[model samples]
Target: MRRKHTLAATAVAGILTVALGTSAAQAEVAADCGPGGPGEFANHTLLVFPGSHQPIYDFVNSAKRSIDLTMYELDDTTMEADLIAAVQRGVDVRVILDGRVGPGSKYYQPGYDKLKAGGVNVVWSNPAYYFTHQKTLTVDDRESLVMTGNLDSYYYNSDRDYALFDANPLDVRAIGQTFDADFADQAVTPSAGSGDLVWSPTTSEDRILDVINGAHRTLLVEQEEMYDTDVINALIAAAQRGVQVKLAIIEECDLYPYLNQLLAAGVQISLNNTSTDTLYSHAKVFVADYGQWDERAEVGSINISNTSLNENRELGVILDAFGPRNQQVLDTLDSVITGDFNDGQTYVATTDPSCG
Candidate 1:
């Protein structure tokens, strides 16, 4: 039996029940999926991109004591100015920017130079890992913002992304601890942070698969890449077992093979085009059994690729519907995902030899 935690009546009110057929064996498997017990009982706020920049700016602007940030890419001059302003206000600011080089990698030297010149304590990320893909900011050791998008101004208007403001003491402390280690280029293991944080190169694969396998009715996913075989197999298994699995991904020819396999397994797939006029699918998010008792959502910078999951420094959070505010976050996520899926074109497989 799964342990039950008491939730406030306000939190439980209006939670709709969902019914889906599951065999006894599958039910047992779902029951064993951990992270299903009580809620974190922390305050959280969700932010959707291509909507407003105020919330993020507000978080940074309000920091009076200290600011610790880790970013994969930093190209927004406005944000750079904000960090410098914070430093000028006598706030201790530290930043770690990814310095890895590769195709499609954004150059960070200009931003690094600008931040250094402006009196911000900024350093390049540790090169031991393939990349430091974590997009997180901790303010005064009190609140943390975990994000799926970069600070690049070029994608601010077109990228579909999400950020969560977590004010939980445990979550904030854990994030700060990891940032301290990462900023100094030292080895460290990230704390579970109220048992909600998901860190890559460690527990991300197992934790993510647990969420997929634990779903009894539906699973909604949005990702920028979909090349990880374990993730592909997990989604296929969930759909095979009567879970309604839907995925929205950026349209790319290299992903056709994976898309065809998912289509063959009855998983509905939608493709978002890379046009500036449309929302690009760059978010890494998952929603499972929304509106149900075990409803949960995850948002972070972890991508569905071997290097991202196994060798990169990444971070994410699993949010359970435990409080009224948390439920609101999940509700907003579900609505946005539904809209994106509906607005995207249904993918159709092509056998063109040039696709290879």
Candidate 2:
């Protein structure tokens, strides 16, 4: 029997349910999928582009089977043409974007419009001002590909951004939740397979903070932008209470005015050494002392930046798993956090009562 887990009541308040139609027999885990190495992507074919305008022609031409393209926008010539062509072929195509149908957007409802016209389901999940800054593609759901950078044409042609691919079982219920939610929810209604996947302009910040504050011990963070004094204070309290607190950051993220405020208050933080270029540790991950059990250890992309946390929309997956999977996921992230990452220069919060 396929058991169901009830997330915090907050997540279930308004979210709908999915009837698992695809059988468990279809789950084929490509051992290659995961981090660092070319993780498993479940599609037979994928063309990862960077930015709002990644190469579209090749993406279009490469559609040998059903495919899903993820990007923030789609206004590039090659992209438009490929999307148009794919729809005509009755390819089961879908798109997820950061913006909705409005002015000043690169590809709003137009992309959604054409896809729907071509019989493809499209969804947008960017929170308020924070652009939904994620680019991912899954072909046949049998293979999945998640990229760190956007797929714009110039970046592809210019050979910018990195792309990784691996195989994975498409039949998993939680993973399918990602695909299902992409189409079910409109721009306003956010859906989460497991509440672990935080989507914003909704309750992302609150839920994340709740998760952080609720932690019993050990909090490690690698944030490019840190502004909320409440979060800083919470971490400080955690530290004071003897919960190991460590923050790894890169100082040039544009939220410095507030970051400096935190710095002046004396928050112990470690800064990454990017040398000439700005230290770019753009991966957003958080792993607490919460021992993984029942697949609750999650790791995905949602940075603690102004855009990621409050202003721009963001997407992240909490890789919840059973004891084994949870251990693997949690241990890997913890290693990355506590290892040579902080370099001893991280800012530490002041012990003043106000700093609390």
Candidate 3:
């Protein structure tokens, strides 16, 4: 069990995104990573999900090797069905279901019992005050599908939801470490909660804001959901301080009621919604100072609210956004807020305004 590289870390949430451009400055020519292509999913050995990915669990059936499923709560029809089929074929399946899958909600107890009876390795994580909200699955640590939307049977078209499946090893390892850490610890603390993210959350929120506050050029963000006042305030400060701060949020429904407060705070806010496209813009990410000033950073997923911060579970990864490989990621992520979506669908404020 004690193997190479002990995973000491964690996952991301909604709006399936395929990032396209991000660099440090015009001074620094953008590093062109190769075309986007997925490595074989079969190459991945570890399969983990942050919260739930029941709808797409069927994709894992493509794997021919080992599969590990982490669930604070199971009984999702998609998971149950997939696991049953996999186990029947002698696939090595282990599930860590939440301890409270019975006598409560609609966590299909019959299915839960069946999985247990069938010898599926399962863990019951109860006494949980916070949610184990991770929905990720890794394949051999070679290919990864880190996503924001849950794998439930929601009436999802590409708009109300989004998930990203990439075959980049750098991205894979980062995501892999996250899963390893979550499953390693009986208690799962995300690498990044809702609004706050980065290497250390000892003062997680404060530390991250400190980094963002110092940015000189641009700050572009695309989060599936957000409602953190502290984060929004810090961003507003940066914008007022002359840093271009632009944010992309789910339209009308400011997941965090306090978000409107940022508009008046000078944080240029944009809605990632279309006129008739009232789908859930569930992807969360932030890209800053690519090819400008002297900083480059990108990160997010279901991060930016007390629910994800303290109530629900979540994850985030910040790469050297300037890395040659991350250009597309930087561009696509930034465009979500400033490109076509920015057409007259933004709110700009002069101070921290209140949303009623």
Candidate 4:
């Protein structure tokens, strides 16, 4: 039995329930999933991409004391102006820009230079790490905005992605420490299986595998890239144990090999190809034992790759069945897997073809 926590009625009213199998009204976690009350899940705002920039800007605009942000990309001038305005208003704003070579590098000089010139304390990420791919914005060391996508306009306005705003003390403190370590270019050991926020290079892989293996009934996943062998093996092991596993990813040629393996193991795989459809998936999330009494969900910038898991700086949150955010994640998964948006191609196990 899960431990129960008491939450205000207003907080309980904010829960996002998973509506599936029937076009019925929104369900509450207290009535649907676990023994715990709505307080079991942290109160957080879920931001779906495509014109979700305003909420992000609004969060940044609300910073009162300080703002510490680390992003893989920043091409949007709207966010830039907000940062500048925050600095001008006597807020201590610090930014860590990715120095590694990539698309964001193109905007470093143009998008970020003006802020540095205007007195914002901006610096490039440590050269030792693969990439600072974590997208986080901490305000007043109390609230945090974690994301599965970049801060670029194209990602917020055009790409399929999501963001999470959390005020959980444990999550806020853990994420703040990680950012401080990265900004100082000092080695930092991330917390192992913290309450909500899970960090890479320490806890992400093992914790994520736990979620995948914990699923006694269902596992739903949506990721941008999938090449991590350990995660693949975990999913295969789960399916062999009779767990219903489903994957919906934006089809990339490199993922075909891994998708084939999962399909061979009875894991349902769907690849969204633009050649035939318009829905492209960019959200990185995992739902364990979905809709079950002990459903667990994770969403963040962490990707299933060796670099993302071990080399790059990444963050994600774990939401239990006690809240609406997890249900919202399930809602998104339902839409993709049920073909509500795009008609995805389902892959089946087949013999390896010869190049000759």
Q: Pick the candidate with the highest TM-score.
A: 1
TM-score of each: 0.86, 0.56, 0.64, 0.82
Of the candidates numbered 1 and 4, which has the greater lDDT value?
A: 1
Model 3 local distance difference test score: 0.49
lDDT of 2 by residue, 119-219 (tens): 66666653334455555665544444444444443333322122323233432233345545544553344456334445545555776676567667666
> Whole-model Cα lDDT per candidate?
0.78, 0.46, 0.49, 0.70
TM-score of 3: 0.64
Residue pairs clashing, model 4: 16-324
Candidate 3's C-alpha runs over 4 A off are 1-59, 71-80, 97-103, 107-120, 124-129, 158-211, 251-257, 272-276, 291-300, 310-312, 322-324, 337-340, 343-356
lDDT for 84 (candidate 3): 68
* Candidate 4 deviant stretches above 4 angstroms: 1-42, 102-104, 192-194, 323-342, 348-356
lDDT of 4: 0.70
lDDT of 4 at 130: 79
Best by lDDT: 1
The order by descending TM-score is 1, 4, 3, 2
